[model samples]
Target: MTQATNDQFLLAARPVGMPKDSDWQRATPALAELADGEVRVKILYISLDPAMRGWMNDARSYVRPVAIGEVMRAGGVGVVVESKSPKFAVGAHVMGVMGVQRYWQGPAEDKGAMLAQVDPAIAPLPAWLNALGMPGMTAYFGLIEVGQPKAGETVVVSGAAGAVGMTVGQVAKHLGCRVVGIAGGEDKCRFVVEELGFDACIDYKAGPVHAGLKQHCPQGVDVYFDNVGGEILDAVLTRINMKARIVICGAISQYNATEAVKGPANYLALLVNRARMEGMLVTDYAARYPEGVATLARWMKEGSFKNREHIVEGFETFPSTLNMLFKGENLGKLVLKVADA
Candidate 1:
């Protein structure tokens, strides 16, 4: 039996550097009676990403910041307990902007915008938010469209063992590129190379990243998919081949900086080598998502892609669990389990 009252974390304050407990206000919002075209959902899992940290700030970006007094924005998976829409069936699995709450109610008119039903039969519920979801889609467009990877080329990915990084490396591998992954720990490095089939894995916490790139890609990097910004981006810039492609995805490293975000000092390498660097937003590829999802799903079916998740229990642990992303405490995707399905 689910609770009658809904638990949620609202944006209380704009975080300065790293978010603190004071940044959020927990509350119980009353569940409303179902209206026509609306569906009530019982949230099971919530995605905790480095991007969420950025959303806490008032800075201008791709989307509007989560306003103070509003429900903290989050992506989640849930079961539709009640449906007043012909579009969605009761008991159907759905994923969307379900927020940091145990329950969510939205309309069918908002499907594919705020809510969309997903098929659990295709993959596990978590995979819909991981390999088969945003992370996979981000990698597909960022690497293939922006990075333009070619066979036999040496491709490098910062945060390689992460959800988006893992997918980018594997997809580049599938395209016949030699893939190098930059991660934090030896365990993450080992798993990416041994299990995810990356050609090399660099432990950024161990030493300077340039040395790792030099050792792993002596021929020079061809396509660099950057997830962490700052120094790592500078390091990769210094090693790019002529006409090389660099794709800017997310920058987890600079998300919590008190100072202004730093641009790569070695950006001049782009001019010297005639290389190109471009930024991308996942939403920009919305129309082609079906094409991308189908391709990733097929690869998953073939055992070439690894679907990994780091799940933390308890919806009440949202604040602490979210901080895990910045500390590199989580391997692969970070998900908060709100409740049992």
Candidate 2:
């Protein structure tokens, strides 16, 4: 097969506050020839996650910052167009941290970043990277490992309609825990309770979150899976039950903060309740991803799990699609369709 150059979104400058169009540079570069054990893939759907914003800044974090002039970092689903790897064949659909680009070339040995073949029959390409993908694993491990909700316990989740939060709520419900969701709007709150099977939902935008939490979780919260940190976190911290567990997931509220991150003032509740608060990185549970995916996919097929995708039409919509997370405009897992299947 003939190799052709591809266009990619490059980081032109570090972003201050929220990123702007001027911070990115769109450039075309000649595709490198496929080397031994390497494969070339044509990217189809790119995952637009809140964590992508944190990755743009050169800060101390779980992952390295995207280098200046490099392709904007992203987790994407793609189809192999060229292959020298024995494990992967041409036409195979795969998912990986392939960045925001049309094509990718990498070695099979580099499993850390190289694309992994995805079974499109089990779930759609986009779902593999969203529901049954990184976000799904995050919700699973974060709740089970960090939150440790016992059956009949009250599980409260922030960012309830989002990819991770949605899954966390549903999984907790399936485990016999009474789930309470906190979302940005009444519509999202209704969807979380009615569709995702949460026992109750609170619209953080409608009124006081602390009151809503009190109304829904009369028994008090046993597990708090926090996604949006800030005021909501502070409110939840005050409602923790004795020996409650708090799972510190992504803090979307503070991601674009120009000011210093504000810690919850109600954190003393942990000491009073003998509770534990732990932050989790999903990558730490990478060894058990297949196990999590299998269980999630089975639940999906059995009608116990639901997966939602907020798909943007084109690659050009990437920038605006990313901003939707901060604005709470996206309903579920946000994805940009870079190419047709």
Candidate 3:
């Protein structure tokens, strides 16, 4: 790859299904000089999330979609190399929607709405982007606020070994719930139970998720933190307890589908069991991020929580590395190391 002054990926065209290389164009754009209350950051690590897939489409969502000819939107952690803002000083490490770029220049308040200073001393930079960042916030709020599992209740989560799911199962266990995870393979299922401390994990690859859930959860599911919607969601619906709370986090399984997202066939199960399934977008809980990060950070210090990140080296690898999430090649949160922090 040729060296550029400042590298960035811009959407060249809206993708039809899975994004292709042709969908984006890499450019070396010149940086703008900062304005008052503005700061410039050198991006260190860029977060690779399943949600980025939805952002590629020009659709109205909880947040505005990434537009054609615009920098592909992403969350990242960086250091304020230049600052004209009272909120942040030069050398301060910050995390925000910095997009897929080598450098970001903007008003502090504009980026800081979903941003916070990251202390590398407390946790490594990558860990911040993993457990203490957006993924952690999503799992924390989605499970605690939306799923609402109680002690002795059975909590089931799909995508149970990915970034959000890994945290959800651990949090539910900490709250005294019987936690069961649904993962794609034996290795992932094993990792969830043996490493992340879930009570049980059903291997969706081994058999039908409904059958596995029956064997694992003997008691009906009280809360379901759903990350991968599709057949797994419909399977979970079959065994929900009355008043079960379903936290709709993401649907990675259907992100690349050429057709519309698959609606749960057993949705009447929500009606039958009087359960409620509510969608969750992490940014809505931004106000409480400090509270979530503080507790999650403490849990990490005490070793009650585990954080995993599959670090793909090089900023140039974004185009190919992103497909890892859809292919289930990444174990936990997928992150791209853009440069040294």
In the predicted model 2, the residue pairs found to clash are none
Instruction: Note the Cα lDDT for every prediction shown.
Output: 0.90, 0.90, 0.89
| Tens-digit per-residue lDDT, 133-218, candidate 3 | 88889999999998888899999988888889899998898899999999888889899999999999998888998898899889
Worst 10 residues of 2 by lDDT: 108-117
- Model 3 pairs in collision: none
RMSD of each: 1.2, 1.1, 2.2
- The list of candidate 1 runs beyond 4 A from truth reads 111-113
| TM-score, model 3 to reference | 0.96
> For model 1, how does the per-residue alpha-carbon lDDT over 124-241 read when each residue is reduced to its tens digit?
9999888778888899989999999989999999998889999999999999999999999999999899999999999999999999999999889999999999999999998999
- Which 10-residue span in candidate 1 carries the lowest summed lDDT? 108-117
| Candidate 2 wrongly placed segments (more than 4 Å) | 1-3
